[model samples]
Target: MKKAGVTPHIVHVSTAYVAGARKGVVPERSLDHDARWRTELAAARAARESVEWDSRRPAVLRRLLAEARKDHGKSGPQSTSAAAEERRKEWVENQLIEYGRLRAQSVGWPDVYTFTKALGERVAEETLIGVMPLSVVRPAIVESSLKHPYPGWIDGFKMADPLILAYGRGILPEFPGLPDGALDIIPVDIVVNATLAVAAAPPPVDEPAYYHVGSGARNPLTFRGIHESVREYFTEHPMPDGGRGQIKVPEWTFPGARRVERQLRTGEKVLSVAQKLLLSAPATKRTRHWQDDLTRQQDKVDFLRKYADLYGVYTEAEVVYTDNKLLALHRSLPADRVEDHGFDAAVVDWHHYLQEVHYPAVTATMRKATVGRRTSNSALPPLKRSANGGDVVAVFDLEGTIVASNVIETYLLARLCDLPRSGWPGELADLVRKLPRYLAAERRDRGEFLRTFMRRYAGADEAGLARIVHDRLGDALLRRSHPEAIRQVRKHRAAGHRTVLITGTVDVLVQPIAGLFDEVVASRLHVRDGRYSGFLESPPLVGEARAAWLRRYAENAGALLTESYAYGDSYSDRPLLEAVGHPIAVNPDPHLYRHARSRRWPVAQWKAYTLPVGDAFLETVP
Candidate 1:
């Protein structure tokens, strides 16, 4: 438009990655052509190699190294030891070459996504934007809009998707950034609007105009805020089917280098002793050499702090520069358009966008795209209770509460008994009888138990067992559900309460049951190729996890924590029960029952096996 007899003004949408690399107070037109970035990238590569090669290194050590490399060249020791530092640089170069080859073979792009973008920015600066009346708009991570147009219309995979997916999957259990780190995010609509306005506005003749359209300047939403908003939204809407629900955003700190340094120092001391002992043994000498190599690799990992500090400084600086540029541009824009077009950052309602628009859109999309599923009739009994005057939250315990038997022990026994079909129950009984002896002798020897059980019962196919659970045992399982428990839940809902069921059962087993309640919160099982990996797919809903889920739920529902009620039968539910105002113990195990009584919490007993309501109730609740 600008070139077609128009002003030919260009608005270059840049990334916060470049802007974040700045140090201290940066000038308005500062570009990312500094030497420090290359050094930091090299350090990061070195760190990645160390993590991949060092088998003996702790996970935390690998993470710290990775983080250090990402934030390289900011504020930390550049070199702890000269030899170690040299090794890191060499390794980084080798890795970069390897990455280049891989990129050529695969996507014809660089191995690192961030590096590719940085290169693109460099090219843009040198060729296109440099000569034109252009404005570079650097957005940190484009997330769901806070307001304007619509909320939660995210079009790209950046921090929001990865963060949410990781948290939901429990891959990221903690935040790994500085407390003050600006989480640069822009809504898609806001970005579009800003880009349009910038294009329409006249650009400065001296330099290519740059606008950092993100939360860092105009809206200034922190990492904490993003985390909290997500938590709150998920809590209220929840995953309709199953899997782990609301997760707490872990704490963050700036002194990640110090934390890593302390760990490395302690680890090196231990490895040194082990290395000496291995070298002394004649048969272990080869292993000792390998260990030495691994140690050297770890040392390289430790040396990554220099790069991390450097990058951190650059990133911080760029953010400052981008913020200043964005502010200046906002100031220069027409007052009417800034107001009418909703381009004024000061007037932007972040809370409204986040809570009202973005969250609802995200929730709806998740429900339709991912969690939508038809509930099986055998999965859960119909809801007998209607919500009444107040909102209600239902909490269900897994194991004996949902399924007729404990899943782990049953699977173990199924393998050991070699019990096929009719014989499975008998074999299970036999295993239970001998469980005490096995426990005394093996003491939680899971590997041995699984191997032995599999050897015995390997002939029975998984399909057959699933079919039995869905058909024969399913009805029995529902019948076994406590009537008193159902009644209590219904009573609360009849009083206009929002009911939720929280459990530690895997989604395959839990999703069907989720249809029984307004929402279901359960433990997640990792599945690959439609089969259970016998591992938790995400963090279990226990202790602090339960409380966190409750908090998210309250935030989403816009309800008071004090007005909520929680019910469970296990000792693990203590944290959850205490989190809400009303705590109810349902068919509590002896220990939990006693504890609940001691705390003056109400206790209710349910008849061990039977759905109190019919299918009609289920239809009514929905």
Candidate 2:
């Protein structure tokens, strides 16, 4: 800035956490002693390039392929590439978050934000401290306005707000902290006042000032104080629970961060074991129900773990910053201006600010935005005039849709039942070794999963496998299939609608069932010299490939797509289901259930053996 006639000054706003892990009265001053600014800045700048380089490695791409297949497998080749990029971005972001936090912690700071704040101060001092007047105003956990503009005004949730809401809504049953530790919360208005004062009258050019705008030293509010205030506010005003009146708030126990993390880990381990055991189970209604329950449990565990890891450090910290320069600036002001424009922490009331201002701002605003709305799981009305069956077609997904068995279970049933009891353990062990890759393939590309899984039959005669498919496997499948789903297919066939069974399952397994349908589209295994080649003849009939195939088939058959019906169960079947007029979700997994809900499509649970009258629609409300 040009400073020929006017007194020029730079009032830089920084955070009080520059004090880092130092346990003492943190005075208002520069905390830059170690030379880390250059290294941290360089590392931050080159982080993405470093991550991109690593992400391209064969192993990393293999892992990213699964995620890409999940979200973009059916989207197209372009979407698949975009998915890979999106996953790469997420990988880089996660790496940066962990790297920053660990690096900051290594140097005694709590998190990356504070460590970088200190770096900013270093840059400012090196660039302008000696050349011009500079005053750095460091605020501690700046929250809603205390008394500026309005009492309870904030743009969004700040540092402490998530924790507060979590506690109020009873999502977090325990508080992780030092019960007596001072929480250095400062109102935005006070920070603003102190910043303006420093800017209006610049500090002396010779001595650069660091003003701490916080309430930790003077009005030190402890964990107990905060808990009581929050409790009082929430006890008076509990949140709504749909039609269940009010949600109950759990009384918090002061379990330190370490113990809480341990508890969460235990829960995670237990859930993991259950999930593994259920992995090989048939996709029965009971199994899917248990899986859904475990999914919700895992989600909650993840949510709590995230909050505990991110906010745990600050909540447990006992750092207290002293606002000496800020108080001195307030003292320098005339007595008449102090009331209207003062940076006074001691005069602020903790309970009043939290209960009347901050908490109200959070609860009232949040409730107003979400109270009147809920996701409708009901399906849309049927078409007014039914089209002729000759003009319409019906499409169905094989696994987790018409049948209660996935690729793994069906293949295992055929293979294990065909082999002697003695060879069962060896076959199972080999499958266990390749389970992760197979699972990834199943989510990403059904055809890939089918091809890879069928490689186990390489040495066996094609006649024997076909025998298993036509006889024992067919009987097992009949017992395992969804009756309601089969009934729907028969209904369409009887009405003269062309029924098509499209699946990534090989032709052998679907051949016995082909008699029930007018047309059957399935994956084909390449056979060389009457031995299985463990490869596919064509691209899998899945993802966007399925949509393209369906379009071609409909055009040749003169099937009216808008008058047709389609049923699917997994996210990979989304393209097929979405191509038709009537899309139904049958025994849908988590992703498909959410998609079906968002689209308000019919969702079925096909209880396999016996589906009750009123239990047609699945309740995926977790």
Candidate 3:
């Protein structure tokens, strides 16, 4: 395009971190720097250990222990043992930090936002330079703009807004990081102006031109300054109805192991008491309060886990040092262009921008995006009853209704009995045949049933079991799902009729299929150490349990239970079908057909798949 006489101004917006080389500072960029990444790695390692920790069996555990002992012995004792240990610990900590930083760099900045920008810079350097007019503008912490087209024009919450919201709501109790640490905040207008200036200026031919636009270097504002400003602003404005009126300025606190231990212990004790009260008490105001308190405490715990180690630590101090370079480039441009596009930061007032404008803009924008739209048709078709006063609640059975297979028992047998595809069909036949007996015995003695089952066949590793489920069982189940059945359910939901898929399948299998239904009533299985304990710790779906779940779903949906529709192909779903007003049999088995016919319920059969409302529903809803 450029060779064809098109002058393309490729505006590459990159992070100021890439310009860190000029300031001699390392930027922590990458997904590896993410707190969740570390947490997940630790969890995976812990899980591996937990699954094979017992050494009495000796095969896997002995190999792991021997490897650990070998590694532990590599570091021999030294002179000044305590000092050496301390030094070693520090070295390990530094290595981990560097590892995280490198990981982040590999992924780009600490998150996707900066990494994409860095990629854009590289693209401009490699392809755009000399080919087309190109200028790379680096913005450090591009925050909410104070004055763009107007005052308080913010795109979205970038960096400081989340922390500010947390602080204002008293959700953040302690301040993390060094009080004196540099907080490089740049208003959006300044960033925009720099972008415009770089774009309008003549490109430096034969070389790539760069501009570092930020605040900390030209006009430094410390973390302390930010905290103070936030406190002052919130105090004056007094968050809606004096809701964070008593805003307190945070003091820098250093990381101490003993202090952390004490805090955790205190928090645990309070949380434990709150949890007990919430579990034991019936639904009431006090119970609700306790639950909220427990949730808030957990949030605090999560927050601490992310920031505790780095709290009050002045980690980085580099500022934008490309000012002279940018200024020189600006001067080289023609006078008219320079006058028209000036990348000046001193003209902007950060405090006024953040407090007076940015906050309000963010709140308004979020409100518009999040608040649900109101429809013109207030008189919606009754979800519980059709126009002819027929039942509308459409309940689907798990195994044969929507899904093609009995996922729960199939998954359990595969995991516990090591039943592969070649052998599972026979095993399934046997299990189904013996299910009545096992269920009867389960009611009498669960421990006996589990022991008998495990003793009979429990030898497969976690990987092998997961492979069998995902590759074999899952594939078969997904393939077997009657396309017409799914289409009908989707149709009912689109027609303003409440649709629910009730199953005796475990959460792992059922949750994946949740996208197919409006509400899922799946069995919850207790999993420990990456494997099922081969027991249903909770009551299975039957009788009152099934009816209660349906009734609650109906109540919450504001639909009449007696005027709702239900569809099933099994005798086991009799209670559920009876609970609803309308019962329909879809591809019903002999027993279900007989039962439905006796009850005078409607029977619908479909040869082709078609969503009830069709193209019109998709166009109107989504």
Q: Estimate the TM-score of every prediction.
A: 0.38, 0.70, 0.47
Misplaced by over 4 Å in model 2 are 1-4, 45-51, 58-91, 277-280, 284-292, 369-540, 548-567, 574-584, 589-603, 606-622
Residues 451-531 of candidate 1: C-alpha lDDT, one tens digit per residue: 333333334444544554464444544554566556655665665667787765444445435566777876554445555
Query: Would you list the rank order by TM-score, best first?
Result: 2, 3, 1
Q: TM-score winner between 1 and 2, please give it.
A: 2
Which predicted model would earn the best lDDT? 2
* Model 3, span 24-80: residue lDDT tens: 443322112222444545654564455333322456444544443332221111212
Model 1 sits at a Cα RMSD from the real structure of: 20.5
Per residue, candidate 2 scores C-alpha lDDT tens digits across 1-622 of 4756765798778888777877768888878468578887888778757876887788988889777865667546655877787887788788878877888888878888778888889888888876789888898888999988788777788888887877766677775788888888888888788888888877788678888888888898888789878888888998765444666787767877778878888998998888676654655667756765676577667778888777777778777788777888899999899987898999998888888888988788656755754423334334323365557878888887887766777677767766776787898898899999988876655666777787866766678788776756676676667887788888787777888999888788886667878889987878888877777788777766777888888898888888888888877777788888888888776566656755778877775655331222111000
Candidate 1 lDDT score at position 156? 55
Please give the TM-score that candidate 3 achieves against the real structure: 0.47
Clashes of each: 56, 0, 7
Give the distance in Å from residue 77's predicted Cα in candidate 1 to where it truly belongs: 51
Sliding window of 10 residues with minimal summed lDDT for model 3: 71-80
- Give each model's whole-structure lDDT: 0.52, 0.77, 0.55
